[model samples]
Target: MTDLPDDLTRFLAGVAPFENHPDAIAPAARAIEIRYLREGQAARPDSGTTFPEDPWSLYIVRSGAVALCDSDGRVLERRGEGELFGHPIRFGQQAAPYTVQAVEDCLLWQLSAVAVRALAERVPELEAFLSSDPGARLRRVEALRTRRERLADLGLRSPVSIGPDAPVAEAAARMAEHQVSCLPVVVDDRIVGILTDRDLRGRVVAVRLDPDSPVEAVMTTEPVCVDQELKIEAALVEMIRRGIHHMPVLADGRLAGVVSAGDLMRTQSPHPLRLVRDLARASDADAVARIARSGPALLAGLVEAGTDVTQLGRMAGLITDATTRRLIELAEAELGPAPVRYAWLAFGSQARLEQGLISDQDNGLLLDDALDADGEAWFLELAERVCNGLDAAGYVFCPGGVMAKGRWRMTRHRWRETFSGWMAEPDPKSVMHCSIFFDLRAVHGDVELAESLRRDVLEQARSSEIFRRFLAAGSVTHRPPIGVFRQFVQETGGDASKGLNLKKRGVIPIVDLARVHALEGALPEVHSEERLRAAAKAEVITERDADDLVHALRFIADIRLRHQVERLRAGEKPDHLVAPDALSGLHRRYLRSAFGIVREAQQALAQRYVL
Candidate 1:
């Protein structure tokens, strides 16, 4: 074997197939041959004079870029610096299936097929990486790139501890010495409770309690704790949901350390907590709108950083939730306190915490049953203020008038009656309403009102087999857009002509399917992924089917999110329509696979419901 150039060897060692196998780098580099092509020049056919008997060689783009095009000259994929192509020829193909043409003047590294195969034989992973389906390879790459950061990755501080019987003064002194705000109360290597600065101020100073009192008196017993392996994003969600500033981190039932809101805010690049704080402090609708405008940019950054699609949606929903709560507070300040208890409800994507870059508002109000003519009027005014404020903050009113401002602002009894009527009637309009309303979640105020209503709704849905069937039938109505020949059925005669409506055709069907299963199982979860998981746990759906639907939903949603981000960057309004050409060849293939999964689920739904 010939010794390779130092720069070439370094570049080869840095990329995949060789990056993890250092020994293979030298042999792989020894087989290298360099070739350059001018702008628009096409690589010679594999069956040409060069290596005519084998007619196969692997080509890597060292600089510039090239396009892999099919027979019709449609680009199948694009490769740039350090990206490799021509792997197909090694797998028993007599010649390359696609034409490789330089989009610009390019330098290429060429390796003969015999040498490449020899390298693959020596490194099993290299063969797997080279021979696997493009879609599968893409998924593996994406999974590694977007894996959520675990709590252990944060480099958390060693927990400062105080025994439950320790005096409050000692706990405070220990906190001061460590420069920490909280302490975990441990007994026999077990965390029994947690104490924060707030607990000290409120319990000791405010109440004039003796500083010599035991720490257990001021500490919160059996406080919420998270595993050290928990995702940072999930931990943040839990803290925000529970309205906590500090939480103890546990590893295998032993107190490992503590994580605070400040820690999460600093680590999370999206700064969701900081954004929520800003929204909470906004004085008026304009200030809220200014903060809301920054969401797209933050989302774009997350997308660029390869944040998981699920996390992206949750972050977006958190911002919306904060904005809505702040708007409600501002509304109350202007309209005076509410005359009766009320629970503001969110429906559709916001309710499911799956909101994308371009989501319209879908919300309603559930008021206390004791409301009279006067109270109703006051609640209506409050709804109008908040709904208009949300519109100004970029949530935008639902075209269907589902906002709390109008008919949707109903007393608790009326809301229950409405849910009952929908299940009882099961008309087309009722079914459509069920699709949206069934995903209801309480955004603010009296949560019990919403929970009670949800319980009744679930009971009614589960008891009424006819209603479940109606839901199943409705779910299969919007099938995925794969045609008879397995080609994409592009939209026609619109601004997005020839593009795919990823939301309607891809995402909604899966959502509807998950909803049907959720209703069948009476699952309390509103998020689609959670609903699917719960349905599987309840044996309403097979785990395999649930897993498929989950993956399908994630992939479709990811594509939709990235598509919208592209539009935002290009100064265009975001929408669900995505041009197939815009996707890389691997993504396009995976999209088809995802759509196929949806189609299969829809078929099963149709057959199960006898639709």
Candidate 2:
């Protein structure tokens, strides 16, 4: 190979996909051709008359800058020094959908498609970085920076087992012999129950049971089990959320091993668990608020670690659940126990287990039908205490007054009647209420009351075709903000005038689409992804369409999360607004594609439901 210019070689050595591979820098430099353009020059004109038409080339802005514009000349992205452009053309696009123009006098380095292909063949990392798929680029970054260990990587040994018919003495003897604290009770190679030291001490030894009693007599049945493929961080989250010390691990539907809290604690950070524990022991609402204040910081750390978006949401939900439960406990202690059985119901994202850092309170109180006027007054006081406590803990009061304090705190019969009336009327206001209240889950108190209400809601919604159509019509109105020629339609007023409402314009459209299908299929799922999957299984939507919607939802959610984390780290309150210009060229393209997917799903929904 011929010697390259010294300056060019040095610059190439500093660029990514080449900086780490010093040996490839020289060859890459050899293939480069330098070009210059005056201010206001179009690098690739719409007529394709400025550059060679045979083999497209990639351009690196060595100095000055350039703007990528849509067909009508609206700026899509601005590229500066060290940033590469014209990747689409080199990656097999017959012609670029957007034109690249020099925003100022520029110095550029250009490499032909053939040479770029040769370099990619030699460097696998370069291949992934240069791929057209945004997911490939994301995966490369995650693998290099934030790849987490899976349960299998912990080198867990096969669990010691005891047959369900085995005597209590034999089980204890086996545990002592193996130095294990828990035993999976197996029958026909399946785990039927679990026996722990706690069970022996609390159930058998404490009660003075016979030593010859069968293991199944005291073992806890239907124990929680985690898959061997689960990430260490996720396993720790589950353990902390459930307050369990030992969890059985399954591989391909059979018992593989057992992971204890100690095992996970050694591998993962103790911050989240410690926070939950502190919340549990919190003496007052102020103490709970103080401990819960660290939630955003904890979430920022998780985002920095490249945790999956779904898991990030799950972590946030856990914090909110713990805080809410603690506040309820404190309130009950102060205001005295409820005069009637009631369930503290969570609506919207919290109930769906997809809460973000910028969540508000959306809850109601479901009281037993046996309540009288005196009991109602008592429950009202309880509701006020919990709502006020939540507001003080940073979940601000709902502007729409959807909290449990007022009309929402109703008896079971009233709730049922309200649901029935909403379905029967199918008016605009009723449809709006159905959207929020239908996605309810019991966060605390009598869960049976919540479950009963859910069943009635589902049955009524299933039979009411007109109500479903009204819901579909209402949902289709929140379309993704994609304009003609595939550009982002940004918000145009107030504080978010320069950005797009990612939560409303991007995430909620998919959420609504999945929800419509879920209701049509009578699915019991609350989470959007779960609803999509369940709808697919019920044949309410094609599997391919379900998968596409899921991918779109995750991609948009990931971008939104990263954006919020950035704002949070900068000491600003996080919101759903995101400026298109703030995103990298690659992310902009993928986000546009995600919005397009949502639009297509909405159109299909409109046709199917005749909205």
Candidate 3:
């Protein structure tokens, strides 16, 4: 053992395990301690080691394959030579939480916890790569997360296909059964043509071809085929450029599967509007309610799938709003007789379209104020009924008591007067109202209603310096939670105390800033992220800044969605509290980078506006 020098011992202590890539103290690995495990030897369970509470370690698989099993027999993770394990332990967890068994003669570098922390502190890139899951890293490399290329990567996989000689009826039945828009016609492992729903409707039915006619007769022969090796971005461009919904995949002149337009659409978080569209077409309120219950599922799915936070919020809002709109439609149909011209003003997320899975109803009504006192009183009654109906339909009532049911939010003239008063003085509350009301997209009735209010508010806000101050101040409320002492600020209390709430901290900061930019730059868009990008193009914000914010927002949203999905899978309510342990190594690294971007953007925004 080479004298076991003091510096060397200290370094080994730092790099004890996978979680401890960076040594905790200032020292370098003079030499790593190597141990070879012969076949049939169980590598020490990471849980077995304890010292100084450094809690960081990395088991370097230097020369053999090792399989990790949970207390249960299920495989948790696997590593071969050059791979490492034990990252889950660094987050203060003691248990290796997984058991390891040598599958072959193995050599390992026993990295100490202290050494790993030190290395992580100094080498950010190494920290990110070493901390991330190998599978996720590989996917990122192959799919390209920063842009639109991932679509093609999915589309060119093995396609659902049938033999060309098969009856058109059979192919059509398969398409309907699978809910796919098209089926590729294959002959001897080569895709010769594609039979789409459109083709069946137009060529088969319109032409009165027999249902049992050969699919080849109705198929779009020699359909555009994308090479499996082609970049996803290029495939997307080609698919869009060609105006084709279904593209056949070919690998080495052999048929791979088919990719549909739906396949081309990069898998996105559960979009509220998509859900609303589904709800609108539904047969009854029970179905609408059932779909509405899926809000948490949608939120979690987006987070799990890695959808950007800002986009996820927007999509979330769209679904919530859509549900509200449908519920309102159903309620109104039952109630009958408008009795007056009015705007069903949706406040909060319905107004902003950036709702979370768990949010309450914040709505108001704006009437023309032309009704008599008795009529007006009756209108308030109607408003309460509508709000209550929406609540029964699944939207909980706002705890803060912001709803059309509240008489303060029911008057039409009061709404206009309220904005006017706010414009006249522009105090903190007034500014807050502006921020919330500014997002109102007007879910139902009188399209011109919300627009009139918006135009007046914009005109007032564009000129009022006080309003800008209030807006800027409100926008700066949520700071990115990245710690100054370290890359990320792990929560330190409660169940979610250690895990970052990406929504409130990371996503909201950028969203609010983007909203401020939109208002100040007089951008027409209401969604904060969208407004930011538009403002950038209009020179209100630099394009680079906008891109960074968008990218960071998207990445964080993806994290939030994934976390939510994991919770859903566990049969827990989808929430912002994601266990740091649940994250793949790559995600944690991306989160760190995402936090950095958010911090930089926030600093810049502060310098430009609040500071």
Candidate 4:
């Protein structure tokens, strides 16, 4: 093994892409060249060398600054220490598309494309770092996120499956024999449906259907499935989204394995789910509140266990839902059954399944159209008890009175009118609430009413161009707090030394852009990551930009989540403000990159709408 120049090896060891792959360093360092440049000096690729499959030079800026430029000398991207510039060109007529020049006195290492390829082959992390694929780049960035073992990383068992033509009694007997909660129903060697314990109980046994009937009668048709390569967090998202317990995993168009809620639960510590189950079993509002109070400690524990901030928010959201549901049950017990069907609507973060350490309640009530005044009053009573219970439980009451207990959130008809009105002629104030309200989802009760309301909002929002413009303007209301020099911009007088509120500035900009793009594309997704995906699918945003935005969103959120966890551990009240100077140079780099992406999106948003 050849030795790397001491300084160069140390820098590579510190950089993200190469940090995890220490074994590859010797081979990489051996076939590399090193150079130092004074300020304003330039480094360009060999024009005489063959284009692309040729060994293009790998340039890693070791110190100071470097700027990539065109052949005509137009500056492209600026790079600092530990930043590498070498495009992975598949088929191209070029000797490196970029002209790498040093903008500041610099130290850099140059490696042959052959050596880089060897390094990539040796290091899985290096491969994603060096790949030009958007998905690969996102994965590289997401690599910084929680390091939980994904379901794909697990050794999944290929469970016994039966054809839809299998008799119900045979399926039941298989269940008894195997003790699995669900089994995939296959047709023509592809999964067509799934049969679960719930399906058998609800569709066959409870209905008193003939046990000898074909399994197709009891199987859930066209079941939602996940790819075998999907993240465990993503599989969790699918289950939560579709309300399914078991997911069939497909590989090469064949059923590879099945994952249940229990299987996915193995990815995390059992504590959060245990807390939720305990919450559900709470006997009264006080019990529910008591369980909710454990949330901060639970959040801290999950963070300590290295859960991704995105998943942490979702876990917190599940806890919130459990607390609310238990409180609602207790409320119902006290107020008696309502006269008509109603939905308990959660707006803002909870609705998006993106709750955090501290959140104010943003919810509404949707009543049956047939509900009389007495029915409305009974619903209000229930809402009041639940809302007050939540406030007592650590979720602060919305100062704007967005809770269902308020008159503004009283009935389904009125809520429909409110949504339709906002989508039609969104006033500034309504536009302010649009991001929060448009994300409304049913927490409990008759979800049909909530779904209909969502459909109405989407339909109106799609056609209402003026509403979209106002909404876009509202989206950019909070700008990322990066100054002209790509430094943190802080409130000069109050909390100046502590630095910017990362949530309001860095995180919210990404959220706002996702919201506007989602609305413009008529996407029904509420979560920021999902909305970006939906927008990309609709071509409302480029796939590259979508990946960038999602990466940025998660990066900023990771910072916020970690900060909140630290605050909770310190027994101090947590807030959005964070000190940039306290962060590592790499994190500072991430902050700059994330804020830059957000600014680009903001520019795109402005170009799309009148601001």
User: Best candidate per TM-score, number?
Assistant: 2
Q: Candidate 4, residues 399-460: lDDT per residue as tens digits?
A: 88888888645666787788777877778888977878888889899988889878878878
lDDT of 1 by residue, 400-444 (tens): 888889789898899989989988888889999889999999999
The window of 10 residues in a row where model 3 has the poorest summed lDDT is 133-142
TM-score of 3: 0.58
Residue 300: error of model 4 in Å? 4.0
All models: lDDT? Answer: 0.83, 0.82, 0.65, 0.77
C-alpha lDDT (0 to 100) for residue 234 of candidate 4? 66
By lDDT: ranked, best first: 1, 2, 4, 3
Q: Cα lDDT for residue 590, model 4?
A: 57
How many times do residue backbones clash in model 4? 0
Q: Which has the better lDDT: candidate 1, or candidate 2?
A: 1
Better of 2 and 3 by lDDT: 2
Per model, state how many residue pairs clash.
0, 0, 59, 0
Q: Candidate 3: global Cα-lDDT?
A: 0.65
Which lDDT tens digits does candidate 3 get at residues 1-611? Answer: 34556744443443322234344323444335677888767777455542223485666665778776666655544566545665652221123456677778898776677666666665544543543333232234224443443433563444678888899899988988777788888888877788898999999889889999888888898889877776443454355334466777777787767766566454443444356557777555677778878767766664555444444565566666666666667666766766777777776555655666666787777776676686676667666666765676568887867777775444456776787788778777876667667776676677687678777777777787677877787777777676542245666676768677777787777777787888787666876667877999999888877776766766676667666676678887667766555765556656655666666666666676656
Error of 2 at 507 (Å): 1.6
Residue 52 error, candidate 4, Å? 20
